[model samples]
Target: MSFLPASADAEFDLLCIGNAIVDVLAPVDAGVPEAEGLVPGSMTLIDAQRADALYGRLEPEQQTGGGSAANTAVAASLLGARTAYLGTVAADALGLAYADDLRRAGIFYPTAPLDAERAGGHSTARCMILVTPDGQRTMSTYLGACTAFGPADLDERAVARSRMLYLEGYLFDPPAAQDAFRRAAEIAHDAGRKVALSLSDPFCVGRHRAAFRALAAGHVDILFANEDEILSLYEAADFGQAAAAAARDVELAVLTRGEKGSVVFCRGERTDIAAQPTTLRDSTGAGDAYAAGFLFGLARGLAIAECGRIGAVAASEVISHFGARPEGDLRALAGV
Candidate 1:
């Protein structure tokens, strides 16, 4: 059987796989947390009942589409690349909303709806993001139907159809999703395409350090991480050591250090790109946006340094907005 899609013999620009979630964002007064005795800036996973309890207490300001890899896919599509998304959601309103949102962003959606029993009883995955005055976000995620997303949910055809496959680290927390990650990597490599991965969060790296190390050494061609996540993955004392270790393992390693800009390592060559100046309104999608810019540049065969610059610009724009998804056309923003 041929690996390429029947419509085109060439590879798609990018294919992303991860959770399908809807983001419910709200602005809270600074002292509200202290008054309510809630911890700030931590991500807590809650069951449907607990999620409902929390949702009842807060006023939802807006609903935006989100999920780490999904956000990256959307940004990649907006940057004028052909992209596809793989994930799971129920056949409910939120799930339909997620599908519609990705479609509007010009990304191909190939997810199957969950069983009616699951959809009827549980809400789709939702992240309640509390944005504080200092431009930081605290997230509480309700996995809901997302937990049922596993290897069976992956589309083999889509994996073989892309030039690059991108996976998020958050999927590691769910044991059922691990096989899906392995499957995507195998399919992508079999098709002669590259596989990319993001270390989703610092705590996530800490949770699955050994598995991540093994994957980074063998399966991952491109790796995306921030200062904390890199440091956690390598158990390094600081950012410098972690960056050096990552460069040795992956074909290309891009590490972002907020305010200090970003660094890219490729085949023993290192390039540093400074962050573009912008008023920081929110830091939600900065990393995902950076990944989109870098991947877009890579797909276009741009120089490594140029890719880092494009990533920096993308990160800058997202930090200036309250949402993880881009507020404007990134292709025009990058002057592509």
Candidate 2:
């Protein structure tokens, strides 16, 4: 399973923390999103009842453990990085299955499912992703027990032992989770481990732009964002302005631009990486997969440009299929 050589100094090469959600995917007509009052290609929060109703209305094509950071953890594991995930699920069948899936993928998931009784009767989080013909997915997520994650759920030991700590922005929506991420960042910094963050969505950036900026400038060593998300974060006039702002904020910034490829800004240098060629099927986890490959490459001591190239390859693989994860041999596709 060792696709790439890695340093064994740390217990895990990358430790990811965020929401633990099961993704239920189904293809529907382009009008489905509008019919459900959901904007196309946007993620919206829904309640339990709403989630249940939506699930019942559509025939599911796939159900798998997925969350931005969790996806990155799984993909990174497939690429041979020692990865671990820390997120809250619930004491339910779906929750247990999610945990099992991560373990099966060779990624450690250290948190136990939250007890439903103690978690205010919240069940496992679920996301109903309705994909339109154009391969754009509209997500309706029920936070469920995932929002119960707090400082107590943070795996301090794992954060301190990992070589790098990665955070997902969606989880930062809750005040408790925000505190937990800040605490985790502190722990990683104290241990001399690098902290990376993914600006999960453009909506997320709008919700916490000030906080994200503060963390990027002080806590996070590496930042991941797509073009839209980065532009939103900086409130910049264009891509160039946004990239400059990101370079000034973090030690390294990996910005993905769908068909335009990605750019890596580090130490006042810019490395432009071309997007990998692939027949697109779904773009659901493009950013997550890219983060996985790029972070895995960094953990494996590859050059920055090579890291971006591997990221591009990983992202391409994910989008060339129906599922968020790669169905192909990622190692072979990456040519590692």
Separate clash counts for every candidate:
0, 0
Could you tell me which 10 consecutive residues in candidate 1 have the lowest summed lDDT? Answer: 1-10
| TM-score of candidate 1 to 2 decimals | 0.93
Q: What TM-score do all the candidates reach, one by one?
A: 0.93, 0.97
The residue-by-residue lDDT of candidate 2 on 65-123, one tens digit each, is: 99989999999999998999999989999999999998999988889888867568999
- Which model scores highest in TM-score? 2
Give the Å shift of residue 277 in candidate 2. 0.7
Candidate 2 residue runs with Cα over 4 Å from true position:
1-8
After best superposition, candidate 1 residue 237: deviation in angstroms?
Answer: 0.7
| Alpha carbon lDDT of each predicted model | 0.84, 0.91
Off by over 4 Å in 1: 1-8, 31-39, 117-121
- Looking at model 2, residue 157 earns an lDDT score of 88
